[model samples]
Target: MKCILFVFGIIALLLCATVQAVDKSACSQPHEIGPCRKADPKFFYNSEKKACEDFLYGGCKGNDNRFDTKEECEKTCL
Candidate 1:
């Protein structure tokens, strides 16, 4: 029983390590421009600005536009 538990623990550790490696590769890269607001309420990709821009501006009276994922936002914007 003890041996079986030990093996299971090792396998779990290995699986966790593999998952970490994959996540590291996926989230390792950095973004350039960062998050920006292109539209108000709803946000979309802004290729030219390099930063997310608000959908609405100038006293529109709405939630501030921002990207949830900084890296993604920067990557798309920048």
Candidate 2:
């Protein structure tokens, strides 16, 4: 049981590390407006354009790629 618990702990640590990495690397992600129906303006880094672009946020369920302002997006992702 102790060995199994140790393995589980290691797996949990790995998962946490992966999540943290993804969060930190949000700038690389594509724009995701998500699946809601509210029109809120937002900015996201466009990797292909190598610039921040504006998009209409649905106000929910979007990824961390979103920023409230163009300056903030440029600061974070550019």
Candidate 3:
């Protein structure tokens, strides 16, 4: 009985490890328009354009493709 319980516990742990929570917005293309900084330089990964494009944030509209650098955006999204 003890051995069976231990195996079950291990299985539960493994299952938990396999499950990962992903942000749909971040991965999705077609960014939003608000909640960004204009002066703050950033790179956004455009899935449709299939490239990291430089954008001037309106300080109130943008999507989850926000990145600090173009390379960083490609590394993560591309």
Candidate 4:
């Protein structure tokens, strides 16, 4: 009975480990940038210009000036 319990515990630990290994995500990598970019990044608030304007997004990396829409940018900065 003790041996059976030990086997079951080992199996459970392996199952948990396998599930965790399979669940390892690629979001942290630069290649997977879909989740990093805002859903709508048409405009960003430019602190220098003191207005919301359009700019290019390389997808993964950006500055604090980024915003999803013009209104969202204006709401905070303006």
TM-score of each: 0.38, 0.68, 0.53, 0.42
Clashing pairs in 2: none
Candidate 4 runs further than 4 Å off: 1-41
Q: What is candidate 1's lDDT per residue for 1-78, written digit by digit as tens?
A: 999999999999999988756544422233223344443233434444544543332233332233455565444344
Residue range with the least summed lDDT across 10 consecutive positions in model 3: 16-25
Pairs clashing in candidate 3?
A: 33-61, 33-62, 34-60, 34-61, 34-62, 35-60, 35-61, 36-59
**Which stretch of 10 consecutive residues in model 1 shows the poorest summed lDDT?**
26-35
Candidates arranged by lDDT, highest first: 2, 3, 4, 1
Q: Output the lDDT of residue 31, model 1.
A: 23
Backbone clashes under 3 angstroms, per model: 13, 0, 8, 0
Residue ranges of candidate 3 with Cα displaced over 4 Å: 1-25, 33-37
Model 4 agreement with the true structure over 1-78: per-residue lDDT tens digits? 999999999999999888655433211212212335454435665545666776556566544555566676565556
Report how far residue 11 has shifted in candidate 2, in Å. Answer: 26
Residue pairs clashing in model 4 are: none
Q: Give the per-residue lDDT digits (tens) of candidate 2, residues 11-62.
A: 9999998876765599987788899979899999999988989999998898
Model 2: lDDT of residue 65 = 95
State the weakest 10-residue window (summed lDDT) of model 2: 16-25
